[model samples]
Target chain A: MKRFWCLFFMIWPVLALYVCWIAPSMGWWFPFTGPTGMKAASPLGERIDDLFYMILYITTATFVGTQIALGYVLFKGAAATDEGNTEKAWYSHGSHNLEVIWTIVPACVLLFIALYQMDVWAQYRVKDSFPSETKQGAIAEVTARQFEWRIRYPGLGPDGKPLPLMPEPQPTDLYTVNDLHAVVGKAVMIILETQDVQHSFFLPELRVKQDAVPGLDIPVWFKASKSGDYTLLCAELCGWGHYKMKARMVAETEDKYLEFLQNLTKSQNYDGVPETPAEGAPVASAAE
Target chain B: MRSKLVALVLCSGMLFVCGCGRTEPQFSYREGLSPRVQEYVRTTVDEKFGTPHKIRVWDKLPIQAHTALATVGEGSKDNSLVVDISGASRPIEPGTEVVWVGGTIMPRGSAPVTVEAFTKDKNLLSLVAAPPAAPKAGDKIVIGPGQTLTHGRLLYAEHCQHCHGVAGDGQGPTAPYLNVRPRDYRKGLFKFTSTKEGMKAHRSDLARVIEDGIPGTYMPSFKLLKPEESHAIIEYVLFLAMRGESEFQMNNLLASDYSDASVANRIKDGETQEKVIEEFVTRVKEGEIDEEVNQRNEKMIADWVSAQAEDAVIVPKEKRNASDEESIKRGRELYLSGNLNCVACHGESGLGDGVQTYSVTKNTDTGKDNVEPGLYDTWGNKLKPRNLRLGMYRGGRRPIDIYARIEAGIKGTPMPAFGAKLTEQQKWDIVNYVLELPHELRTPGTGVAPASPATKPAPVATTAH
Candidate 1:
């Protein structure tokens, strides 16, 4: 019974560690790889995780070394034969050498980690480093309000070129108001705004999350590596209906995207209606 | 003594360290905390300390292997009943039997018996004799007459006072944000309706609006209420609206005595403040001075409310005249074709599923796209397009009612005021055409000869103010 108890105690910690590492990957804890699931969204996230493991390994080694020293000292003292010749254990008032070594070592380690993270963070946030082709190819604006995200794509202008970003005070040039569609293989700059309260635009797969602040324009940029449908979600708590704010982004080949944009534009204007109608009545009559 | 003292010192030191280092469970749901407080806690903690290892309800203590006593009544007369529940989880479900530690009695003669269950904290979960019986079909919940007033008071405190003001004066906390300020329930003029001139919304119409909600604006749908509950709320809303209107009219009457504009002007010029006050007080006391005026205004408001209610009804006499399946088929073709161009905005499915929806401007009020405010007819007015899928015709859903709207055009809106444009038979054809868009658009039908062309020009309403 004593041997069985000792074995059980030894095996418990190993079993716990096994569960923690393997359960998440095997779908026991997090069953899916989408939003709300535990999987990392971008390659950058994986890289950061790798850095975290490295630091953890170093700290764990230090902890184990100190614990072993403590155990050895306790064992030696327990075995000492004192029998009233009790000279108190030797005591040191201070240890300047030990203090300096501990302090400087930790400071250097922290500085190294901080310096290592700067480049990764900058690469993830800064737009210019992205390939020009990828940047230009997938451009769309996502506006968040209350509990919903509104996506806008710039359509080609009358000159058969992409419309220049309109200056303020000209409400007409805004992509959504003008029914603009983004051409494939072009950069999409999303200008996010909130109508009522605060909301966050989060695209997990793209590793992009930005708060939609009212009365302020927050810009977020992303390039889809492959063309498929992706979900857009509101990560901020706007109101009771926040869960319902959902939209979809469709990425397609450059040719297919252009075809969709042109067809959509043509459908907006019908051929049967006269360009200029006779007096009061203009174009087609049905309004209701 | 020395060894014992050393052992005691070591144990004390160990206790101190354990107590200082132990983690405390976080408690949520403190009273008076704003709803956003929890969100702020979650975000800030995640940003700083990283995610929690696990979350558990901090208030509940885990149950050990034992049974708790269940009591049923107050002191002395309290009866005990045995409920053999053990090692139960926190957040115990109702009807769970806990062990009764005391005596049980069968009641006799005029006295009542009570039963109760307790949590580990000694808080009462329930105090009843037995499980409630299931409700019978067609039987209403009878909570007694006083429940109406209790419910009304609670509803008013929760929803109405925030916008209608504590006194129903339209001076709500959110009043400042609204562009077209909230309706002073007292004046009682509602804008959207099929009502002729003046009218309070039909109780059902008010409930419908509240349930489905206005498409644009801050008014959100309260679709959570059941049918009967919504009716009760509507009643409460009407009560407040009427009470406020009466008060406003009384104030208006006291402020005005208009014998004649010239006479009033002369009196105003010559009279002192005291004299003016005296005259107003005297006129109000006599009750004869503005009786005619007050009566006229009151009647007008009542008539308007009545007219709106009448307009809200769905008349069935206007269903399609012919039973021929062939006519409906022909009508469906015209609906989708370029001649009518209904599909341009309404979409091919007539479910308001057009591609134009993606491009339509967002409504500033409700934050929905495709709700353009300037889509009114020749008259500069605000109009909303119909959402065909809902099938709740704004002007009454009857076949003829829809026919009339299509024929005359909705006066002020983008629903061009279509009577003269399409032929008489074509108008009927379009009606059948719309019905076909949703269910079966591809069906074939026999063609009907076109009716005689409309002779009179389409009548347009006067320009909006």
Candidate 2:
């Protein structure tokens, strides 16, 4: 019965360790691998990931050390309780030195983590710390409503380059829903606002999140390291249809992005007229 | 101890096995008709379009593509049916039920008869019971619940039924809380459509709404759905809308004479109760009500089909006028001009708080004055004129979109069409001015023109911070 208790106590730690060891390979680790494993998609995201790993290592070491000490003590105590043994079991109220060491150690570790993550935190939240390119202007305005993301981009100018996005919607502004496009490898910013309740803009791949408080214009920025489609989701429970707020961010090359804006302008101004009328044909007759 | 462990393991194993199999939730048709409909009207509609479990799709309706349609071939006999299975989207085997959907020969909408035996080689079917009348050549038949509609029903249940209601009545569980109510498709009136006035919305218009969603409203985009999946859902929505419309027309047919209020009025006017009852029975017996209903149903089907035609769409005769200072100036004049009288509803400053909203108006239903002064749509829901300064256009924000709204007017609303009164150029001018309403700075209270950049007026309520 004593052996059974000792083995039962020891089995839990072994199972926990085994599960942790296989978690990454099973695509169950943090950073939400998505299709790619444990790799952040942005430069700042990489730094954030590094900080996450640092804390994870510290916690893992603490967990294993405590579990091993528990198992060893359990086994030793079980052996001492054998029927043939007559040794006196030593018991103490507490160890002052052990308590002092544990308290100071965790306090120092918490202090270190706080100090280490300050730079990333400032870069993410502090407006002055944003990249110089993003400081110029926001690329688009994202308005989160009941259950959708409405994106508005600046219309292209005569030079075929995008005009500066105005704080107010311009007549030339182009609109799209649930689709946010940005140029890859460049830090771009978006002005986030909510028409109704509170919503959180979460980009899991880029490790970026910001709360879109009503009556406030929040700025959120990220640079995609590689060009691809990533998810944009609302992490906050805004309403009954909160789960329906799913959008995608498409990061592409500069030329492709410009072409997209040009196409949007053309479509937004569509006058029910065909693009090119048949040769020597009347344009008005084509609609029928 | 070993026996206890074995028992524990066996019990857990049974639990795991039980959890393995999952049953797909079945969707059902809406059960009862609206309370406004008479009892006889409900019975007639139900007989023509079966119950929840056994839905009968009328062949003449535009919803035929959603069902598995088969044609009665030349070799069909009194006892056996020879069908062309080309329209059958899903597999059909013995014991499957088939419904005869076409032709006027079979009365009271034929019931679904099961196939006892079938031979694939000869495309022959032997029914367990004979149909009321032999299905002649070119008659339409449906085998089982149509696969497309089945797929559509499942998707609609998951994505749309929460707010659209199972009957597409706009009274879903989450509807009451919304300020701008979800559309009641029973009237077949969509506010934002590319088609001309008095026409049903084109399939593309509805698709765009699903893909882009309506801004300033609770309807969100479901752009992630595959094209085919979206199409199937649209078909299902159309089915519900058409079914609701059919019931609504039938209720109207009897409501004028046989309604509770109408019958009471007749009794007050010195007619015996027995006389009114006798009149209704005679009408039903002579099939006069049925003929009227059939005529209305045929008209509804024709209108829906005609809306799909190319000419039904409103096409601009000329390209849009350039949005310049001169065009904006001309548009502002037209806005305040008595000819357009846009200021009656849309305030002089375009705040949507015009005098019309505060004045008492006649109720169209009872021909009496309304207690509260407000604008009400055909659906009996109170609506406010759009605040143009907010820069939120529900139908759409495109220049051509505004043009269409001006030309055709918003269907099922107080907004009247100016297409006949105004020329194409004049309409374009208003489009330009309305588009610029958000950006144009105006003096508050005075309703004056754009204030000079030097003189600062009271702050306007801008959408932006």
TM-score attained by model 2: 0.79
**Per-residue lDDT of B1-465 in model 1, one digit per residue for the tens?**
999999999999999888887663222211222223224333322332221222111111111111122233232212222222332222343444333223432233423223355444543334345323211222221112122223443565565556656545556777666543444555554434333222344555566555544433444445545554555555445544544444344434433332234336647788654565466557546865457435745574565356445444323222233423465556667667787666665666565545444455444434554445233222222333555644334443324445655654543333432555666566666765453333332234523322222222212111222
lDDT (Cα, 0-100) at B345 in candidate 1? 58
The TM-score of predicted model 1 comes to: 0.36
In model 2, which residue pairs have backbone atoms overlapping below 3 Å? none
Q: What proportion of the true contacts does each candidate reproduce?
A: 0.00, 0.34
Can you tell me which runs of candidate 2 are displaced by over 4 Å?
A1-38, A72-89, A277-288, B1-55, B64-145, B257-286, B364-366, B444-465
- By summed lDDT, which 10 consecutive residues of candidate 2 chain B come out lowest? B453-462
What DockQ does every candidate get? 0.03, 0.25
Give model 1's docking category: incorrect
User: What TM-score does each of the candidates earn?
Assistant: 0.36, 0.79
Q: B1-465, model 2: which lDDT tens digit per residue?
A: 999999999999999999999663222233343233355665676666543345566767776444356788898887588887765434465667777767526767567677777777888877888888877988887776555667777888889888887777888889998888988888777888888988888877888889888888899998877776778787777777777778777766677776677777888999877888787778878998889998988888888888889998888887777766677778889998999888888888898877778888666666677778987677777888889988888888777788889888888887878888888888888987888787666666533243122122112122333
